[model samples]
Target: METVTRRRTVFDLFVIDADDTLWESALYFERAEEDFILLTRSLGFDSPSVRRLVHSRDIERLALTGYGARPYLGTLRAVLDELCPRRPSWADSAFAEISRALLEHPVILLPGARQSLEWLRERDLPMIVYTMGEQDHQLSKFSRSGLSDLVEECVVVERKTPEALADLLSSKGVEPSRSLVIGNSPRSDVNPALKVGASAILCSRERLWQAEKEDILDPGRVHHLETLSDLPSLLSFLEAAPDSASRDL
Candidate 1:
């Protein structure tokens, strides 16, 4: 809804998500998709067919194996094979350009992310960053964003599941209720935290490829926000509420 900009003096720990929530990660992948389209077109392939084939292959691979760089790169290769049959003569150059573009893509931090982290840090709240993806890519984004130093810990988790979140909180001796998870995905971020008895702030940003909406844990226990700018007031409101205080205890 609407959030009044106010400072929150409570909250022991804040766990934030990287990728689309914190930075412009999806944009890079989107650019890669565009480059893929051009590459396929130049190779005498139909764009829609190539996309459909790759999408199907990716879904199948993700279901059977898992989602990661290997499977993703494999999906691209599969699409290339389907389009040009055993890698065309121009494949090498096209692939290199696409890869370079993806690599050189900048990580654009969302408005209010750094400010919010700094504010919480100033208030002595322990803020941690957690994301799921290839470790190298995720960490590289963090380094580019320059917010890595603001976080006490930067965790690149394999899977963003409820059990994983619970384990992390338990291992750190942080009660679930005392922890807050802020992220963009309902499936990966919000529901998992809510399932683990932690309050979640779901920043409602339009993601380019949300291939995991099929499974979302308890969707009710989430506070939806238009942007992270609303976070401060939401935290303040929650802290002022007696119910939230009891849950934290």
Candidate 2:
């Protein structure tokens, strides 16, 4: 763990990110992409080249379609159409399988996600699972995560921007200084929190999505943790010594 400046404050609300932060999200998407690559390979396309195009298209389509399994499948379909205009009937079946696997993937929580949330709940810390993407799709995952009972609410937005974070804090009556944003994405989670004056905890993961890659805007205001399990200890330390000078952990 890494800490920056010390501040005498206790977080009133915890804004947690859903998807990759809490459960297995990007791993399923990666599997779908591998399936797409295999399909293209069977159709005589270069595997490396197909993978590159899929990644490029995926990032490019974010502005126009936003994030979600359906939109992601659309990107793959577009890539397939471009690669093989005369695709085989089997290709359709393959896509259907891929879609089913991606859309209906199980909500497997990350190690310590449940325990950490339970710890926070025991302390009466209010938490909200804040996520972005298609509302129905995101909400569906939230409902299945088994974390619904722990958090006070679940918020889904088309995109997570600085303005969106600000509005959410304002509506919740949470001061930015007294709020903590916890998530895995620098682009969507950490940066937005910094922009809105909220402290952020970056739960770094091994398999991060390309679209979520970005530099941390303000490193000093952010805490980097290896996993959710470490969160409780960090917060407990802060609560115990609010005025202690920050040091590397």
Candidate 3:
């Protein structure tokens, strides 16, 4: 069966999120996992045993703490402690190295991100970012990322919700109906955008956690896309939006 894709045409502003949405951030955790594996191997543990322990620990941490830098650091510490109690010296050094690396590492922007932002800049379309995190960490990333100058404004909110987005939009003179929110998480980005009458674009990432699948499948108001390059076409789609005429008129 052929499916009809809905077209958007009224959007005037683009509000994007950083972290996993714009760049390659989560791979730090993956590298930490490799460190865990090496530690387990040194302790004479097999791959299966190491995998089971790490997976179990990760699940526990997520359930208790959700996702954040501190929780991730704690999780890594726990894994190291479990695998190398006798070699506490090694664990200390490895953990320190991983933590330092994560703190300094900037996320590698996805392909076409820079070019797409440049295109939007050339068009004079107001671009902004809405993100949730510690002020220093988030702000520092933006300053170091080189994408900071491209955006007209940046909002670091305490939380990500419909009310929060609406508040930000109202303060900035951006109408929800004319704003487009682009990000990687459907739960955090799409649902909230829809609730506030803002449109959304969901850019699929390479490593979306399994728990996030439901949101992606049932995103309330979003255009699912494979890459950032699709953004130009999406903007065109919005520019060519269908006219709505009322029967009374």
Candidate 4:
């Protein structure tokens, strides 16, 4: 598929994701993963083995437990306890502390995320924070994220599937050709929106969850950027030249 620059940017609505794309989320999860790896390594497993097993269990447990920091942390803890119950490190209170920290980590906005939101807000554009995971957890992240005041509303769901995207666009009366979905997860954000015919902007991150890794299918309506800081300019460029035709990525 040809990597295409957005054909037009005068979108009527913008649906943004709330996790690593907008703030320091996956970093915290990564930190917790490292800590857990260290703790497990102390119990006997090598670093690589621990990482592999943890990742394997994490993906496996998602189907049973769904997405949430608590569930993820629990997966790590369960793996540790199951494999190293007799190890001294397994009894350490520090392990529990690490898990709690992962669940309660602070929500810090990504660089320029706040500024970008304000830029869109000042332009009087409509934006929605559409995210998945536990309702209270996602809501809390949004509240502490300093973005709750900026978006029109926060819609939390169990999954960010194409059907959900279609429903959202349908309910909002947002034409697929005149809307954008910006997020870090191609699995949850880019693919679904593009599948539904909406343009998508993937704000790439350094450490994406394996589950979120996927190929971009409709590159004609899907694009990539390094950070949220780059968003306002892209939107401005697109909106300013709404009649512009697609260009190669």
Candidate 5:
């Protein structure tokens, strides 16, 4: 008797997330948060209280304002206004500067971001940059990222849910089983993708948006790679043992 190898199904469509996955978006926001803390502390507000309030308001405002640089800036400003009714001139100026910094920040690729993307391009995989944010901002980041020439398109959305993922996959005529969703957040990337029967690859990062973290229901179809560069090897392994990918770890 001879052992048989279950050939892995080739993932034709690869939809990758922007932000913390490819470039350093969250880092700037984190820095801005620290700046906000410093500014509020200078205005007599407790640093810890300012951070807590900013985080709280940012999350709550998402449903109403959607995700974007402006919304985040607004949340921090709102916190400042509520705590200090008579905001100083410098406070407003500082907030405006912070907003400009976030909006004008360069798209700095991560350590293995470009190399990994290049590898995928060489392999000729159908890859798309799918992210949730203000359309103009997200597209602008893509243009500056140096990856615009590599990927077919950069998609912007207000939210990434199972339904949204399903629609994207369907629009491309790619079945869930033959598609891959890679991102840092489980809320916006992994869980919703898995729910739609699509395999997800998490570009794991230490510090991520609090809301993006969610429970993974189907770990079998999920693959965790430390960096984007690790993807080629993982895909190779899956090619050899496709059916066993879920239990490989």
Candidate 6:
């Protein structure tokens, strides 16, 4: 018997974000933070002050911890220890509850996430869910998301860098010009796409995290959309319009 390997499919690749882009992620984090804040306030710390410290520490720890639910919870725990040197009897259990809630939260897909992906799938668009975080945790979420069948693959990295994006396209034999990166983060999604000479679509959200905030390097090269539902229409318009006209859009 001879072994045969199928060539990877190549097309105008769609690189999509997972957390807070296709599903409800930040909301659970926000809930956990609020719970932590309440717990700390019960211990006599000011709510706003604890929030400020937690926010600062979260960003500071990213260099060491990267991004994931566990690392984020670890940041909160560190903050709690800093504020309250003497460990309370019930603190550990309460914090564990918070961590469990966040880690085990249901995968609630964003509006039109399914419809948009189905539309692209029906058109034979090659999509890869390119996200960054702890591999097992992210893969667990992807499995529960009910979107696995629609996309070709889900890629999890520790971070999203220009070089990372370039390497992903290279692995798929996809040209940068024939790629579209869609996500909410200006720092992670839009900037990397711009750096790789790929088209970008920013699905803007009201409560993006501080670390994900950054001025887009080239706003003119990125398309802005309110939700995933608009994606199919945008693609349709781009396909119908002349290349010169679509460039400005």
CA-only RMSD, every prediction: 5.0, 4.4, 6.1, 4.7, 2.8, 6.1
- 16-90, model 6: which lDDT tens digit per residue? 999989998988999999999999988899999999999999989999999989999999999988999797879
lDDT of 1 by residue, 1-249 (tens): 566466544555788988778877767776787788888888778888877877788777776555555456667777776667767567777787777777667778898888888877776788889998677877777888999788857888878989989988988899888788988887788888878888777887776465755444555566688877777776666668755452432
lDDT of 5 by residue, 205-246 (tens): 998888777888777667888998888787777666645463
- Candidate 1 backbone clash number: 0
Q: How close is candidate 2 to the true structure, as a TM-score?
A: 0.93
The regions of model 4 sitting more than 4 angstroms off are 1-9, 86-92, 242-249
Local accuracy of candidate 3 as per-residue lDDT tens digits, 95-126: 68877777677668887787778878888878
Q: Which candidate is the best by lDDT?
A: 6
What is the C-alpha lDDT profile of model 4 across 35-149, one tens digit per residue? 9888777766899988888999999999998887888988987888778776675456878899778878999888878988999899888899999889998888888887878
The clash number for model 4 is 0
For each candidate, what is the lDDT?
Answer: 0.76, 0.89, 0.71, 0.83, 0.84, 0.89
Q: After superposition, how far is residue 3 of candidate 4 from its true place, in Å?
A: 29
Please tell me which model should have the higher TM-score, number 2 or number 5. Answer: 2
lDDT of 2: 0.89
Using lDDT as the yardstick, the better of models 2 and 4 is: 2
As for candidate 4, its clashing pairs are: none
How badly does each model clash, as a count of residue pairs?
0, 0, 2, 0, 0, 0
Alpha-carbon shift of residue 71 in model 5 (angstroms): 1.0
lDDT of the structure predicted as candidate 1: 0.76
- Clashing pairs for predicted structure model 1, backbone only: none
lDDT of 5 at 5: 55
Superposition error at 143 for model 6 (Å): 0.9
TM-scores for all predictions:
0.87, 0.93, 0.78, 0.88, 0.91, 0.93
